[model samples]
Target chain A: MVSGIREMKRLPVGIQTAGWFDEKDPAKSFRFARECGFESVDYNIDTIIRIGRDEAGNSYSFMDKTDEDLLQYYEPFKAAAEVNNIKISQIHAHYPTYVVGDEERNAYHIKVMERILFVSRFLECPAVVIHPTKTPDRGQEREINLTMCRNMIPAALKYNVMICIENSLKRINKNVVQAIWTDVEEINWYIDTLNAEAGKEVFGFCLDTGHSHIVGRDVEMLIEDLGSRLKVLHIHDNNGTEDEHLIPYTQNPGNKGMGQIGWDGVIKALRKMNYEGALSFECARGVKLLPEGARREGMELISAIGRYFRKAIIEG
Target chain B: MKEKLLVGIGSKELLPESNLEDNLRMLKECGFESVIYSIKENDLKMQANRHVYFGAFFKAAKNAGIAISQIHFKYDEEIKECNDYIESLHNALHICNTLKCPFLVIDPIQLKDSVQEKEINLKIYRSLTPVAKKYDIKICLINTIKCAGGYHQHAIQGACADAAEAVWYIDTLNVEAGEEIFGFCLDTGCANVTARDMERFIITLGSRLKCVHISDNNGISDDHLMPYTQTLGQVDWQGFIAGLNRIGYEGALTFDVSRSIHTFPEEVRPHAMKVIAAVGKCMRKSIEAES
Candidate 1:
C-alpha cells in the first residue's frame, strides 16, 4: 500500500497545453497538446483580430459568434480532446481587445472576459492566462499598468476566474514582462502586494522555462524560490540564446546549451516544487508540416512527455 | 573520353572533429577523391579568425592523395555583423589563396522575399565578390529552399518527370550573376524535393556547373536518406554517376546530407557511399551504352 502511495507521488505536473505542443500540427493541434500529457490547454483569446480589409472593403473578422460556428471549426478537435480528457487552462491575454477607456469599450471587454470565463468554467479550468503588455520604457513602471489592472480585476472577480500573468520572453530589444515589472524581484513584490491588497489570491505566476532561461535565471532556482506559489509551469527547451523551442533532449544534446536549462534538471525541479499544474510545451519543431501532421505529432509528443515524467519523478 | 569525376565528402559530413588530418584520413579511407572544406564559426572564434582549415585542407589533400575541389564559405545569420563577415571572408580567401582548390563555393542565406532577397543578394556580391576576385578563385553559388527567402523558392516536384522549366531558372541566374561566377552546384536532394529533373537539368545547364552535392532521398520527400532507403531520392545510382560522365562533367561530388555525425554518424556517411556505389551500377550501364 505504501509502495503504491509512493508511486502515485511521482511528477505532479502543473502544466497546460501550449499551441506549439505539437511541433507539427496546426489544426486539431490542441488535441495533440492534450495527448502530450498536459493537464491544461490554452487558446487565442480575443481572436477578433482586425487583420486588414477584404475585397468587399470590410475588416477581416477572425472569431465569429456562436458555438455552432466554433463547433463547425472545432468539431473533430473538441471530440478528440474530450475523448483524451484534456482540460482547458488559460486564454492567452486578449489585450488588443480589452483596452479600458470608454465605458462602452470597457463594457465590451468585460463581456468578452465574461464569455471567456464562462467557457473556461464550463471546461472546469481554474484560471485564465494573459500577457499584460509589451515592456514599456520604464521597466517595472507598474503604476499605470497596476491602475488599469486594479480597475479591471473587479470585473475579473465578478467572473470568479483567477488571472495568471505569464512572463514573456524578450522580443526585438525588450522583455515584455519588465515594462510592467522590471525584473523577477519586482514581479514577486507585485504578486505579494496584489495578494495582500485583495485579501485573497487575485493573481499567480506562470513560470515559462524559456523566458527564465533567456533572462539568465536558473529555472530550478525559480521553482525553489516561488515554491508552491508558482502556478502555471510552461515546459519548453531553449539553448540560452534564441528561443529555438525544441523538445527536450533533441537540441544540442551534448552541451549545457545557451539557456543552460537541461531537461533532467527541469523535470527534477518540477518535482521539487511539488507543482500541481500541467507541464505545457510551447516549442518549435518544424514549420512545413501540414496541419494534420502537425496535430498528430503534438499527440505523440504529449504521450512521450507522460512517459518521461513517469520515469523522472519519485513520490514521497 | 570522360573525367572520372572527383567526388568528395565535405568536412561538414564529418563534423564535431575540426581535425583536418583525421578528417582527410577518413576521407581517403572512404575513397572520396576530392573534398570541400567547411569552416565553422566557432573555429573562426577560437582560432582568432585564422584560415586554419585552408592550410590544413591543402596539406590534407596532398597527404591523402586527394584533390581539393571547392572551399565553401559557411553561412550563419549573424554574419550581418561586420566582424563575422570579415571572418567569413578570411576563411574564403584562405582557401582561394592558400588551398589548391580551383573554385570557392558560397551559399548565401535563402532570402525570404524577392525584396529582401535582392537586398541579401546584393549584400552577398557587395561583400564577397571582390574577395573571391582578389584571390583569383572562381566563385559559385548553390540554391536551397524552405519557408524563408527564395533559396528554395522553387520546391521539388516529382510529379513532372524532372521539370525542365524549373531547372532553367537556376541556369539563368548563374548566367546573370557575375564574372568568376563559375556555375551551379546542383544539389540532388534539393532537386528531388523541388522536383527538378537531375539528368535533364544538368544536360540543359551543359557544363556551366562546377560541383554536385550528391545525396540519396526517399521518394516521399527529401529525407536525405542513405541511397537504397527506398526514398524518392534514389536515382539509378550507377546511371546517375554515369550520366554525369555522359555530360563530360568533371568537378567535385560532395555529399551535403544534414545529419550530424556526432549523433547518427555511423549510419549516414557510409550509407551515402554505399548508395553511390549502388548508383555506380547505373553509371556502368551508361558507360556500356556510350561504349
Candidate 2:
C-alpha cells in the first residue's frame, strides 16, 4: 500500500561512531546510533591507526594487515550495519595526509589511505574524508596536497569511492589562520583539478562547518560556491573561536545573533543547492561533554537537531 | 634560577561530590600541590553561618596538604542586577578569607559597546574594593573574549583581553585604592582563542600577573584543552614557558582543562589527570631550565 504513495525526498541524518559507542563492539554502537534516530553513521577509522608510537615504542596500524585480514577485521561492522539497518554513509580517513618534509611518513599515510578506500568500499560507504596537509606556506601546501590526492586516484578508482577534501585551519605564530582548501575557490580548484586528472569525478569537497566558522568564512557562501561538488558535510557548531565540535543552536542559546555559527543560513543554503548527502554530525565533543550515564541524552539531542535540519531541508 | 611553579587544578572536576574532605584528599592523591576553589551561588546561599562549612573546608585542605591558592566566584550574567552580583561577590570574599586563599579570579562582564563594558566592570570591581580590602584578598581580573553575533560574527577582543588595557585597569584600580589591591590572571586559553601572542602578553603583565589559567585551544574557540594536544600548533608552549621564565612567575601552574578531561572516556579520566600533572612538571622544569 505504501508503494503507491509518493514519498518526499529526505536527507539521511547521521553521526560519528567515535564517542557514542564502545569501540570493542561495533554492534552496540550501531544499535545505539539507530536508537538515537540516526539513519546512517560516519565510520571512524581513525582509531585503528595509531598516529604515534606507544609508550613501549611499538607502532600499531590495522592498515598493515593483509587485504583479507583487514576485511575480516571489519566484518563485525558490516554485519552490525546490516542488522541495525543503518546505512554506512562515509568513512573518515586518518588525518595529516601529507606530513611536511617527512616523505617516509607521508608515503606510509598514502598506503594507509589506499587501504582505507578498500575498507570504505567493503563497508558500502560512498566517500571518505581526508584532511588537507597544513603548513605556513600556501603554495607548498597546495603542491603537496595535490600530489597526495593524485597518488590516491588509482585506489579511489579501483574502489569506486570518492575522495573528500575537507576545509581546514592552521596555527601560524600562535594564531588560528586559514589553511589550504579553506578558500572556496581553492577547494573548488582542487576538486575540479583532481577530477579532470582522474578523467572522472574522483574527488569532492567535505565542508566542515566548524572549520569554516573559525576561519571566518560565510557558511552559506561556501555551500553555494561548492554547489554540486559538495559531497559530504561535517555539521557542527562553535562560538567562532575554538573547534569545540558542539551541537548547533547550543552555541547561541539566547539567539542574540552574535558569535555562533548561523545554522539557519546553513540549512537555507543546503536547501537551495538541493544537497542530498547526510546531515552528518562530527560532534564528538557534544557527546563527550555529558557524563557516561547521560551520554545517550546528548546523542538523542544531536539526532533531534539532525531531524530538524532534515525537515527544513526537505520541506522547504 | 626562578622558583618552580606549583601544579594545581580547578576543583570543578575534582570535587564532583559534595564531600569536601574526600575531594581534597582525592586532589592530593592525584598529585596536585594546590587547588582553585570554585565557589558557586548555592555554596554562598546555603550557609547562614558561613564559617561552619568553610571552616571544615579549610581544615580538610590543610589536612590533605593541599594549598588553597585561589577562589573563583561564579559570575552570573542572568542576575541582570549590579547589586545582586556585588552581594554574591561580597559573600565570596568572606569564604575566601575563611579558606585563607589569597587571590580571587573574577571575569570581566562583557557588553556590546567597549565604553559600557569598561564602565560597568570598573564600577562592579570598584564596589568590591572595600570587601576585598577587608578580606586581604587580591582581586584578579581575567581576560575575556566577546562573541557578539552579526557581521563581526566570531569572537573579537573583549574586556581586558589586551595586556595594555588589563594593566591600565589594574594600575588605575590600585591607584584609586591607594594600595596594591588589584592584579591580573592571564587565561591562556582565552588569549589563544583571541590569537594573542602568549609571550608578549605575559611579558607585558610581568610582575602584575598574580595567577594563571593554563589551558590550550585550537586558536578559535575556548576549548580549554591541554597544551600541545591540539592538532594545530594553536597554543605556543615554547612562548608560554619563555614568557613565564622571563617574568619569573611564582604563582601556581593552575589548569582549567575540564573540557579536555571530559573528552576522554570516564574510566580514562584518572590517567588523564596524571598525564596533565606530568605535563605540568615538565613545563615547570622547562621554565626553570637555564636557557
Give the runs in model 2 whose Cα sits over 4 Å from its true position: A1-10, A51-60, A253-258, B1-291
True contacts kept of each: 0.00, 0.00
Off by over 4 Å in 1: A1-40, A46-80, A96-107, A135-140, A155-158, A170-182, A253-260, A284-295, A314-316, B1-291
Instruction: Name the top TM-score candidate.
Output: 2
Q: How would the docking of model 2 be graded?
A: incorrect
- lDDT string, candidate 2, B1-291, tens digits: 523488898876667647777877776776788888887766677768889877887898899888888998767446578897888888888888999999998888877787987888899899989988888899999998878567545677888999999999999999999888899999898898788999999999999998998887657667677654554435887899899999988888998887666654344455456556666777777878834
C-alpha local distance difference test of each model: 0.53, 0.79
- Model 1 reaches an interface RMSD of 12.7
Error of 1 at B260 (Å): 7.1
User: Which whole-number lDDT from 0 to 100 does residue B180 have in model 1?
Assistant: 36
Q: What share of the true interface contacts does candidate 1 keep?
A: 0.00
